[model samples]
Target: MVENAASATGPSIATRIGKLDLPAPTLMGSGCYGSGEEYAPFVDLAGIGGIVLKSVTRFPRLGNAPPRLVATPSGLLNAIGLQNPGIDAYLENDVAKFAERPCAVIGSVAGFSVDDYAYVTERLAARDEIDAIELNISCPNVGSEGETFACDPGLAEQATRAARRVTAKTLIVKLSPNVTDIAAIARVVEAAGADALAVVNTVRGMAIDVETAKPRLGNTTGGLSGAAIRPIAVLAVWEVARAVKIPIVGQGGIENARDALEFILAGASAVSIGTGNFTDPRAPQTVADGLRSYLAERRIASLRDVVGKANPGFAGVR
Candidate 1:
């Protein structure tokens, strides 16, 4: 085990979330890690828990337009859409890279309808390189007057059920933080057969240019991520944890181990490093290592023991 100031032999930080077994409780968030290729040269991939790629759809998307990114006081605004080579091309090109990675690789699937989600997930489910599938239902549903699937419990359950019917692979539903009742959505997805839940995706946000009297993002709207939304993400995780029995992958504004630890204490069994990777190429490794040091300092046996430590009747910490 990685030691702190006082040396003490203890259990490994290894933990299990749903059907996925992670060596560390830290993961490379989708979009930031970019299929685990961008940061491979800067960090050791063998140490972290897993790597989730950006959202992939059934067909190629141009992904919003230019000027789709801007730095905020404490976060990043992005409207990248779901730019990818589509599912067929991705299965041929990107996923092939993980064949010999020797680490967990998760695929994030997004779609416009229930069938779209199922088709993409079905393709991903057939792949051996992918250890799990995260459903990005935050995209607008054309069948529902542009309302996001994550924003409606009924739509969320339908999307999840459609995907579940096709793949026995670990299904992780990424919930939206913009909902009025996140716990209600969490329960519906769990009942629909989600093995685990990604507590929250980017919070809904937007920025405007005062000079031009126009929206800053090309899409006119974007998702807000980074340090600005950590508190919201934690609260969402806490609510979902109390409402369901499945594991939770907490994300949002996790930059370092402290932020990641905060999520774990709140109820996240695993923490994802999102916008942090942009400023620090080694964010994933740094956070994972820091977690080891934290376990040693607190004398916690493993990350599983620290998960949801702050929740009532928490079993991880004694």
Candidate 2:
């Protein structure tokens, strides 16, 4: 049944991740989108579904040294080291500002241990302005320990369970692509109580300077994002979608609607835009507009109709 009688108005782009509902399916990826305010001047925040604020840890971090970003042929490598003002300062100074955002405000929590996730999530999700929480267990740029939770199934389950115990708000667990069996990890996370999963964070990669025979980034290794990781992310979403019942926020190298559609077809309920913002801050609008156009052209009743349409093994909830 067409929920909206106006079929000509185009298919509904609205989507749900756990208890949270979004008018648009396009979300600005965490870390890439800075608090939804910085890009407000260049793009309409209302045009997108939500903004995943940069990850905040229990303590302040100075971030990595200079040369944090390196543009490759099809992608960019970055090692920013999760710089933030710590939970105390963020709650006191920054959480209040999110109240003005036109779209859903999703807070991101990064930590060194399970306790850190619980502490930050309890405080951040307690804020009325925050619509949801994203547990960033797959930050590859913060050194070896940074991605430990995401790569290790036990730690991933423990961290996710810890955060789940603190809040009833939607929790999206970010998984690492560097792992050997991502779907297995996804299953464990889902069982541990993640409402939704951010399928496949940046692929681990590094670039070196030939002349100096040294690593280009100060951290030596960085997470790669952009067109380079789309296939990896898509496959991860496909496999994880088949292995779990929770919604999947497909991301990686999504730059346009077609790129996002690939994930939706592979069983992702929604898509996230990160490096694409760097290519063009208006990328979110372009994707949102393009998705509506695609639906209108196909006469699809809603974007949900196409979720997992291409993947036979998809197991996500409608």
Candidate 3:
């Protein structure tokens, strides 16, 4: 167990992802925290860094069928299929509500084509409520078309560049962990003008039902998250950090401050909590507290001082 520090005035966890300045380094992962409203009753919205709203597409999606979620031995598998109201409806009903959120509100845009990315990003970022735009180019549950932009370097560049052309607001391209060379993709996306990179979306996996002799998820295959992919996520952040100078929002199986610290040591500027929220609604605040305690114990003045401390190959700003 980590010992609590008497005072949290020692190190600063504030971080900047692109142009968005976060008071804390913890961001709530998209699809996990719904616009920062669902968790407000249980957790303090202003205590965390920011919230990446669920991915919104150009068209409304029905999402996947039932059995969209399954608990694995060490993680959780999900195939939500980017289910959300279309951008039109989102702008009308959702965007207005974000004005009241205490923390940063990052809009997530997921699409099937480069044009779709540009269109969605332009509209979403134009709103005053959105602090930044996260291009979810690597959604694993929507079948082959979903992850195509992230797998193909050319498509990744095209999508990133298209979105870049539309919005000067921070453009964070979410990379897929299913790729063969994530570092290469990171370089491509960076060259195309991405302000930051979301190290990994989720790892692909599936479960079989013994009695039914069929897949458990409605989509057959789902993206695996939680501790199961922590190593993979850390390695991805490490490699991408060395390959690009942009900031990285590290995620994947991060459950506590210790888990979040691993990504920071591996070169991530910030950490995102997704599945961790399910374990505890107050996980975000706990992580923030734990990070402060860890830094205070070591007499560290700021969290940035320890970024990439463990990775000798880290190329991001120190």
- For each candidate in the order shown, give its overall lDDT on alpha carbons: 0.81, 0.91, 0.92
Please give, for residues 47-88, the per-residue lDDT of candidate 1 as tens digits. Answer: 778888788989987777778798998999887777788998
**How are the candidates ranked when ordered by lDDT, highest leading?**
3, 2, 1
Single out the weakest 10-residue window by summed lDDT for candidate 3: 1-10
Which regions in candidate 3 have their CA more than 4 angstroms from the true location?
1-8
* Candidate No. with top lDDT: 3
* Candidate 2 residue pairs that clash: none
Residue pairs that clash (backbone atoms under 3 angstroms), model 1: 305-316
Candidate 3: C-alpha RMSD to true structure equals 3.2
In model 1, how large is the Cα lDDT of residue 147?
A: 38
Name every residue pair that clashes in candidate 3: 226-253
Stretches of candidate 2 above 4 Å error?
1-8
C-alpha lDDT of candidate 1 relative to the true structure: 0.81
lDDT score for residue 11 of model 1: 42
The TM-score obtained by model 3 is 0.97
